[model samples]
Target: MITVTIYTHQDDITLDQLKADLDSLQSTVEHQVVTIDIDTDETLRKEMHGSTPLIKVGPYTLRPPFNRQDLEVTLRSAQDRVKYYQDDAEYIKRVERGRRVSGADRFSYWFSKQYMLVLNALVLLFVGLPFLAPVMMKQGLTGPARVIYAVYSPLCHQLSFRSWFLFGEQAYYPRELAGIEGVISYEELTQAETIDLNAARRFVGNEMVGYKVAFCQRDIAIYGGIFLFGVIFALTGRKIPGLKWYLWVLFGLVPIGIDGSSQLPSLAKSFFPSWMIIRESTPLLRSVTGLLFGITTAWFMYPMIEETMLETRKILGQKMEVLKQTQKANR
Candidate 1:
């Protein structure tokens, strides 16, 4: 007997039509119809969306957008395929060999086994880009520098007053209005006519002022902290457990949230009452708070991700091992 299964959630538009078609085939092939509601199995839902209502006829399985003609043809082919393998010993061996996963599958399984290496590479790339932007500008390569700035702009405010500047008189150029004592303010340097916030952000610095990194001071601290923690976790073989949810909120989420969020309304000092003070954050405070936020957040997320990756590694490693054993036995 053949098994034709339909997989769907509650709201599938074409479920009934597909079901009717599968039912029509039951009499011809001695098949039983089974329905799988993938909503009940999230894993299955993710694995097979829009590719469900699978019709398994003998050795072959049919996916969606299939018609009555396609189903009939597939059933015939599947039956023929089964009979050919059963009757011919050489065909059976050839089919089995063909069924064995290819080198690409082996590579994927290998990758899943070494998922940490991939994770490390991604974190390094993310942190490395902002640092590279200033280097590109320092070399007078404005094109590459602009590209980097554009890439990071969405992720950061890129305000000249806030970001780190390499090869400059100081590490940063703050807004004169910020009131950090003794340091050359944004007004002291190239200076400003009116506060051109957008132009200030666009300025990556000339030779006199030094090149600005694509990210702000706080953002640099945040991503830098994350990269540092990622390295530490990898070196420890990723055995660490995830940070507790509450502590994650306390250490990872709160400080940065308070510092950053409080600064938002401060943008409109005119909007605030005369009695209420809108405090501008100094670069030192920004960096310190950002660092705390980043480390705690990475400590929270990366270990949990590592746990999932480790399970994936175990499953894929076992699959590869079984495949190797089967191949050896067949040889």
Candidate 2:
């Protein structure tokens, strides 16, 4: 049977007349009527408001000022077309696909709307867990704390000299070569070889020096900066403009690159001549550059993601509206 769909607003007075016209043709055509209230949805209202009492007879649409003759002609044409194309594979597929809305579509619609919230929560959890490791160790929960450290070890260098410590006399223990004075240096305290990467990575603090965070100073700062801006972005209702590409390259990439690259000279000092000078970045510089990288990277990327998600929402929302109308008609 052919289906006749009518899209109408509450204030539409021609709806009764349109229905009566369709009812008059009941004996001539086998069809079902589905009336949808466009006023209920803003998007629907915007789309169908200008064409209230819009009638769809199969694939044919009849706009306002259409009379009984117009309805009859359209309906008869739709009936003849359906009769010829009923068994056509492409026609059948299109009809079936239009009527069916799957669970995955519903999920996509929901995720498209709530994606930012999900992202923020995930980043919070990711950035928060590393701090939790030190807290767990402070409370003597070494087993769970070690698990956190182990899980994060692959993601970060986790070197004691490059990590922040909780419940310690000093927040950070830099290498003596870092030129950070007024605190006990890693070389003086641990007596380990300054260039020994493995030894530095293996040293997790003791009672005198509290447990190190699972993430290194720079890594924590980076994720912390991301989480910080995420909160700010959400708080601002996500209307923030995206950072320009060149600005991101200048502010986000350059400082971090310089700070990180400058430190490499210190690592390769043995290969350099005795007169060559080597430099190492202090924790403060590392945190600053890392934070800049994180914030600017998010600033550059999140707004673009928001734009894509907005388009996804628009498309999915339209599909959902169609699905809603279809379900209402079926009932």
Candidate 3:
């Protein structure tokens, strides 16, 4: 039987209203609806101390305030999925555990694998490329390095002054750009009498030339750090302890909140930097974000491989079964 439990705060939405809605839909579904007032319920209060208006069902929790129609739709979809999986258990298990070892069961397996590889490569490219600027510039391979910088331009403004320059003044792109135009050189731009858009902005500098990441030192560190963590965790087969997928979703999003809300002028400035720095520095924060990206990349590849291998095993198992049946028939 399908069960829905809705938890709410004191004087929020009334139980009568919820009951009325459930009664209205009673004829449409074979389900039971229960409401738990979190303010009064000691056990629920302790369990859901920070989270109110939380929904708890078997193996799934839906937090409010969600659209009632959407919730209903999800319930219906879930019910159907449960029924289908239960009905097909025997065959599903048979397919899941393959009987034979075979090569590329389908053409799509190769495509999925390729897509996953490309995604992983992109992740590494973003994570490690910034660190390689010095190495590339030293080898006179600034052309390829500039291409990388150009690719990341939309994502990061690539501020020359803000970014930690790897090499001396010669390694800097904006300085070189300043020289080429002949209108302004590095020394003239840096020592300008007046601060104007036409003159070099300390962070962005000449917008007319050169490319860089849109963010400052802090942002690159965070994103690049997360990407590197993902690569390591993917290799190590590690996961965050005691965090379900739902919790991880919330935890992963806290960084965005910490980073964005810190900029709001209304809030106390002290709270801003405190939360922002902690949010950025926390190992839990970085690891989870990395795991999320890595898992998404891995899922795309793992499923296709498993499915193809399963199909191949089934085919070989069928052949063996057929041979046995033939021998029995002949005997």
The 0-to-1 C-alpha lDDT of every candidate, in the order given, reads 0.74, 0.83, 0.48
| Residue-level lDDT for 40 in candidate 3 | 56
Report the CA-based lDDT of candidate 1 relative to the real structure.
0.74
User: Model 2, which residues run further than 4 Å from truth?
Assistant: 1-94, 272-277, 329-331
Comparing 1 with 2 on TM-score, the higher-scoring candidate is: 2
Cα deviation at 72, candidate 1, in Å, is 39
Report the lDDT tens digits of candidate 2 across residue range 149-265: 889989998888889998988898888888887999988888766568887777778878988888988887888888888888878877899999999999999999998887776
TM-score for each candidate, following the candidate numbering? 0.67, 0.76, 0.35
Residue 319 displacement (Å), model 1: 1.8
Candidate 3's displacement at residue 329, Å, is: 14
Q: lDDT by residue for model 3 over 244-266, one digit each (tens)?
A: 44543454445445543433422
TM-score ranking of the models: 2, 1, 3
Rank order by lDDT, top first?
Answer: 2, 1, 3
**Clashing pairs in model 1?**
none
Q: How high a TM-score does candidate 1 get?
A: 0.67
Off by over 4 Å in 1: 1-99
Query: How many angstroms is residue 232 displaced in model 2 relative to the true structure, after the best TM-score fit?
Result: 2.2
Candidate 3 off by > 4 Å? 1-121, 138-140, 168-219, 236-251, 260-331
TM-score of 2: 0.76
- What value does the lDDT take at residue 261 in candidate 2? 83
Model 1 residue 43 distance off true place after TM-score fit, in angstroms: 21
